[model samples]
Target: MTVRERLMYIAKNRYARRIPLTSRLKAVLRAYLHERGVIDNDNLFISVENKILGARSIQDRLRQYGNLTGVNNEVTVSPNAFRRTFCRLKVEAGTNIFVSQRLTGHQSLEILRRYVEIYGKDLEEAIEKGFEGL
Candidate 1:
C-alpha cells in the first residue's frame, strides 16, 4: 500500500486516532519509539510530557531542538522546510501535483508551486527515462 493509504495509530484527545503515514515514515516512527524506549503509548509521536504531539507543538519543539543542535544558526528551522520537502519529494516520486496539494493541505496551486522546486537534473532524468525506448 502507498504511504498515503496506510493508517497510523495514535492517541488523541482521550481517544484513539488513526492517520495516514507512508511506510518509510512508519519505520521512522517505530525507530524513534524503539530508541526512546516507549513501550505502551499508542501515539507514535509525543512530547517529553507524555502528551501526543500536534502540528504546532511539533513545530515548536523542532525549532527548539534545531536551536539546541545549532541547526537554526545554519538553516532556518521552520515548517516550510518540511512542507516544501514533502511537496518536492511527492512530485519527484511521480505523485500528481493536485494530489500532493491536497495531501499537504495547500489551498491553491500557486502556494503549492512555491513549495515544489524542479531542478534541471530532475527534468533531464525525466526526459531520458521517457525517451529510453527510442
Candidate 2:
C-alpha cells in the first residue's frame, strides 16, 4: 500500500472519535486495514496517547537491541533512518519532491532531496531492458 494510505489507516483505527474524514481517505484506510488486519494492541508502531504500541519507546529499545544483536561496527539504530526510508520509497514511487517533503515534515525540499538518490542498478537495468524490448 502507499504511504498516504498507511497514514490514513493509522489515523482511523486509532482515532475512534467522530472526527471528520475525507471519503477518499476512508476508502483507502479501509483497504489497508482489510489487507493488514488490525495491528497488535501492543505493537510498537502506534502512539502512546492512543493506548497502543508506539515508536518512541520502540526506538529506545531498538538502540539497546541493536547493540546486543548487531556487530560492534554495525550497531546503529536511528529513527531518522525510517524517515529516510520513507523518502526513498516515495521518490521511487514517483511522488513529487515537494509532496515527499511535506509528508516527511521536512522544512525544505532541498533537505528531502538529500534523502533520496537515483539507484545505479535501477537506471542501468531500465536501459538494458529497453534495449532488449527494442
Candidate 3:
C-alpha cells in the first residue's frame, strides 16, 4: 500500500493493526473485506451469521487451528501467545518501539518494554551488540 493509503487506514481505523501479509492471508482478508462491502458494523470480526464473536469463540477457533496444524504440543495455545509473539517479532524486526506500541495497543512504552524484556528471544545477541567493541 502507498503511504497515503496506509496512513488513511490508520487514521480511519479504531483498532488499527498491520498484520504481516502472506499471499494466502492477504487473499483471505481481502475476501473478507469484500464480503463486508457496504455493511457497517462496530465489530470488524462479526460472523457471517451476524453474531459478535466473544473471547471464548475466538479461543475455541485458536484451539481448533492449533490442533489442525499440529503446532507446539508442549506449549498451551492461547491468545496471549499470539499477542506476545507479535510484540516480540516487532521488537526483533527493529520496528520503532513507539510504532510497535501503537500497533499492539499498548498504553505506554514501559508496558511495551516489559513485553520485550519478557519475550525477546535474542537477549544474548542484544547484550552482545550493546557491549560490542568493549
Best by lDDT, which number? 1
Badly placed stretches (over 4 Å) of model 2 are 1-58, 65-77
TM-score of each: 0.56, 0.47, 0.59
Q: Per-residue alpha-carbon lDDT of model 3 for 21-85, expressed as tens digits?
A: 55676678779878787465766577778778777888899899888888857666888788777
Residue 91 miss distance in model 3 (angstroms): 0.9
Which pairs clash in model 1? 3-22
What candidate 1 gets wrong by more than 4 Å, as runs, is 2-5, 8-20, 36-41, 89-95, 117-134
Q: Judged by TM-score relative to the true structure, which candidate is superior, 2 or 3?
A: 3
lDDT tens digits by residue: candidate 1, 1-134 = 56566674434234443456777877886788678784567776776777787978878988999999999998788777876877989988899988887677666999888788667998999899999979
Separately for all candidates shown, the number of backbone clashes (residues 3 or more apart, or on different chains) is 1, 0, 0
Candidate 3 residue runs with Cα over 4 Å from true position: 1-27, 33-43, 46-49, 72-74, 118-121, 125-134
**Which pairs in model 2 have colliding backbones?**
none
C-alpha lDDT (0 to 100) for residue 50 of candidate 2: 47
Residue 122 lDDT (model 1): 81
lDDT, residue 2, candidate 1? 61
